[model samples]
Target: MNQEFIDHIKALIKNKAQSQLKDELQKLHPADIAELLNDLSYTEAKDIYRLLDNEIAADVLVEMDEDIRKDFLELLPSATIAKRFIDHMDTDDAVDLMRDLDTEKQSEILSHIDDVEQAGNIVDLLKYDEHTAGGLMATEMVKVNENLSMPECLKEMRAQAEELDEIHYVYVVDDDDRLQGVFPLKKVITSPSVSKVKHVMKKDPISVKVDTPLDEVAQIIEKYDLVALPVVDSIGRLAGIITVDDVMDEIREQAEKDYQLASGLSQDVETDDNLFKQTKARLPWLLIGMIGGMGNSILIEGFESTLTTEMSYYIPLIGGTGGNVGTQSSALVVQGLANSSLDSKETVKQVSKEAVVALVNATIISMLVYIFNFFRFGPTAIITYSVSLSLFSVVMFASIFGTLVPMTLERLKIDPAIATGPFISITNDIVGMMFYMMLTRLLS
Candidate 1:
């Protein structure tokens, strides 16, 4: 809604027109209500949120921004949280909300849940690392036995389907509850009632282990174009299922985090986050960049006589080019790693490719600078050759350095995106200045 509509709602809130406010909010989708709540004060949000029905309130709670939801939940009692929100949420979402609460609060909320089985499932899921398939999956999917006849399987599926939002596949399992196959809904009509579930279902269906990494799970779903992927335990028993929507949400959160790290933030920081959190995420890198700048100044001071002020004139051209080239190279390598297109096994090949591209860029850039210097300072001046050679060396070194750092980080099990941040930019700047001074000293 626009600011004008929000203002109208705020006016209703101020006037304490409960019925009118309730009527207007009832008309909004859960996502829209969540958005509207985000734009209001805690008092206003709480007042408006109370008017929503339990199911819509649970959905709106899930849709609300994480920061807002955290604060909003704090004002509520544990019993209220369990009854009004947790009762209506899917197991996965409930676990997520539980994770945000303190240990004492979590126990209180869990105790208030009416569904003992669902509460147990949430507790079981919470044991896994949040970055695993086990944590991301929901226990709400439909599963039937392989021994059932077609008619029996269909009956079981219909009963379970009523409880779920949508049925992507009806999982078939053995008497041991081990996954045997996936039952296609089309087969329900096409296959005869006389056939056994195992005989008609798609056998040896693709699935991921519960302990599989979340990223690997996303890759499997993406590769096979699955709407839902079943999770299995160590013994191949069906555990839970991860839906496409959950995977998409995970992907978006991961992308945002990677972007923040690449931009030099240590952790995720929203604009609305408190001042200390914002500063905390941003300060360490700014301090590191400061140290790098000081190091550059000291290096230049040490070579004040050799640099001869004339060559110093192009320090910006040399440093800027190196930083820009390094940033470009690191960004591409990070991107390739994220999308799985570039494997660490091909490190030498990737670096060699970047080197060749660097050579072409270096030659063009250095030669262009050399020509400009020839006209700007006389052709016979040391400034001409030294500037061009320094640019050439800086470009080549920066390119190779940039490409290698991320690849090495990946091999060492560190995040490669860190290399694409101020880490690359500052390192290249300092090193580029050193190359410039050394080249100028040699030429003179």
Candidate 2:
């Protein structure tokens, strides 16, 4: 959004010039409107929102950041929210919005929704845990009975197409509504010479169960290069469909969350969040890093008698090098796990591979540091050999430690992202200090 346009809207809002503000809003996209809302105060947002038509309001609401949308939605009445926004959203989006509200608020909003089928679908979807395939799938889809004739299937498709805004794929189901196959759109138009839908449909389609984890669903879709995947019940009955767009949106959200974790935030947070919330999300890791710093100091104090003053000068180099090596190893492991390129079962293979890479990295780094120190201080000085050996030991140990932590976390069903950033850096800093001091003592 243009800064001039936003300032103009603000001025119009301040002046209470509703007519001109509405006209200008009409010229902007829903995403632009959403961005403007995020930048405005509650009263100003509400004023600008009132000028939008129900459909556009719904679109803007969806486009807004979840934090901004949740705060904005709370100020609206249940009936106003239901009629003006939820009614226009897809069932999946509706579920997402509803999840933000309390059960009582959700019930009140659902009661205000005019479409009984849409309301029922949202209710059924709410029964699912939010991180599963069922919660992400939409009840809206076109399906034909496997036993239907070509003409019958076409009629069914025409009738169903009337309800949906867009169609990704046509599904074929048995008498029990158990998913059987996918009926291609091209096959539908050409009216393939087959007698029944069963003969023409592509059987044994790729799919996931309703309770499948969101990660598994994303991987299956990406692996198959599918635009959409059918969701099935425990008994193999078709429940809903997951379109790739929805999956992509979820993947983006998860990526943001993981990025935040890697940056040391303990919880979900946004820039729009108030001071307390932002502090709460950030303080835990900062405190942990502080403790790790204290621990490193105590280690140095304990080894002070054995450590030379010159060795202290090289502590920063060793600690920083260790942290960098650890961070790189954990990041690669996390990325591999996310893309399914590295199997959790293959932890030994991954660690073994990382060790070989670390050996090469450790050798190169130690040699470079040794040569630098050799030129600065004579090769006979114990400090020269101590710092170089410490660098080599720290690099190898940090690399192996970083790789092991995330792999263990993955096997234990913990988010591997926590293994990055402060967690790895703090740990490596303390351990690297210990390595430098011990190697210095031995060489002395």
Candidate 3:
């Protein structure tokens, strides 16, 4: 991560000093190695990747940016990718990596994977909707039958723990494999060995169905402060476990996606993406904004006869105020929805609160603008009263419109984030112009 270390690595790569590069890479963490790979050309990165052992390479692959990892994966054969990387990766991570590949490539990679069980688990995971708990869950977890004694449970846990990197909880299941309870890791040392697992374990454990949405899964984990959450099938059978680390990744990805949507991007994009990709992601929103601008011009043209030079000077102020207010309202609504702080049922309550806030803001802003206009024009001037009234109306309308649009979208099962930024601003701008022109004409 340091500049000097990066410069040294680049020099070693340039000089083709394989021994030094291997020694240096071994000293760094997988995530740090991934950061270095991101800064290097694909060929240079691949050279460094080849020096890593299979386990570290798998970890490094997971840590790299998706676009870079995709390109890197393409350079390797299915056999090497499967036997070397996928075999060493967690089920959820393997599914994530495989999802980016074509069907044929996925099949080939599966075929080459040495562990039949792992390949099967990946295939099963791929069947779930990518946005759900099942897709994020991994089969790697420690579980024991509820009938086992504490000593027996501990023995079984030891065997299962060998296959896992870390053990968060020991799940207890019935004869039917239905999840009955959770065996706390602390109980292993504290509890007496005479008791059965079912008696010793905490009964009625909190869990999620496989079909639960990824966002809800994140909320559950966060709310419970869990390091892992159990996933259940329709029959209440324990299917897999979702680790906190994976849930954290899901949370980050969702936040990034929402942020992109709020910014008016049509798709996920990064600065390193190709020109065409970047253009494609940005152009749709830009075109929409342009259309909105043209529409505003036409609206102004329609009201041309009513607008005196003084009246026309206030148009920008009205539109800009409305757009700024709308954007702020929509952003708050979108963030509240994302974090589960705002419920669809609370729409009326939220809008009412927003209206009160808007009223305060509108009153202050309109009063300030009116005072300035009254001093500049005569107090009796139509422009003064009309402009002030229009500002007040536009602020109230923009705030209410912004709050309701996103909440309505969410109610309709649409992503509310799309209603933020440009969409809200454009809508508020056009409507603000109409309010100003209509109020002015009537007042005059």
Candidate 4:
């Protein structure tokens, strides 16, 4: 991604120098080629793509952003796509590309694919839900029967490893293809060749069912520090394997989705998205904030006669403080839920802990404001007591309200992230105004 390399590629593309372009592409990694393509126009990108070897082309296709890849694929013929990219890609990557196409297009691509086994694997993967372990697993792992000797196992592995790009672990299966153990790659060189594979293999290997959720699969891989995890059918037969790279992609996507929701976006969106798409994702939360502002205005107007100009000056402070406190509380709850550190069952404990923290914060903030107002307005002034008291009450209420809302959302099987940012801030602003007006009236 250096400027000099990019400029060289751009110059070659501009001159229509296919020979130089192919030479430069061969020296760059597939990901770097993808980055160059992203910076180019459709025609320019197509030219660069055509220069890549089939294996590199397949890798570059996977590295491209999903939106860009879809448009790129549409410009190519089905036969070319199948023969050049799909045939060389891993089963998981092929399934991902197929998921983006229509049924007719998928069928056409599958028919054009030269490898029958790869096509069959893609079709079987397409049958599973996209958010499950089956959808994330690949049929490229090396497995051997437990009854085979070490020499026999190594021979079988050589044949299987030829088709795969990387080998992390060798699985040992029984006569029924049931996953029984895992044999480490290092054992092939270190262990005695006279022994059967089962004797050297570690028994009771860790694995997930094909029906397991993607989130749980990610957690297992992360917890065990595994390079790859095995997937099994209900009957304990080996189905496929999910690599660490695939789990990393899922984790990154989930993090981005949560960040978007917390920022008040209704859907996944990028800066390069069209104006209509950007507006649609942002408008709902903006409308909610508008309604909340109107509600606060009405609440203030109801107490207009009870307040002097001095009291009116403190309205912004009350609303802004509450909003800040509420946003902080909701953000913490959302993050805890996402990282699995907070459980819905422990809602009471979390709220209680938040209350203690809020109490200390409320007392310090209220006292500082009270001291400042007391010097300006004198000890007997209604503005002094009412502003400070309203602040204390608002802080306590906002903190508890924010903590409870997200936790309740999680308990109800809803995404808790939506309760953060603008949603909590707007709700707290309206409630804070109501509290300020009520406290002033009662004190006066």
> What lDDT is obtained when candidate 4 is compared to the true structure?
0.91
Most accurate candidate by lDDT:
3
TM-score of 2: 0.96
Relative to the unseen true structure, what is the C-alpha lDDT of residue 165 in candidate 3, on a scale of 0 to 100? 86
User: Stretches of candidate 2 above 4 Å error?
Assistant: 14-19, 192-194
Candidate 4 has what TM-score? Answer: 0.96
Runs off by more than 4 Å, candidate 3: none
Give all TM-scores, in the order shown: 0.97, 0.96, 0.98, 0.96
User: For residues 240-318, could you state the per-residue lDDT of candidate 1 as single tens digits?
Assistant: 9999999889889998998999899999999988999999999999999999999999999999889676776788888
Q: State in Å the error of residue 263, model 1.
A: 0.9
lDDT of each: 0.91, 0.91, 0.92, 0.91
Q: Which tens-of-lDDT digit does each residue in 186-270 have in candidate 2?
A: 8866775457899888999999999999988999999999999999999999999999988888899899999999999999998
Q: What C-alpha lDDT, on a 0 to 100 scale, does residue 275 get in candidate 4?
A: 100
Candidate 2: which pairs clash?
A: none
- Cα deviation of 279 in candidate 4 (Å)? 1.2
Q: What is the per-residue lDDT of model 4 for residues 183-208, given as tens digits with 9 covering 90 to 100?
A: 98888888899989999999999999
Clashing pairs for model 4 are: none
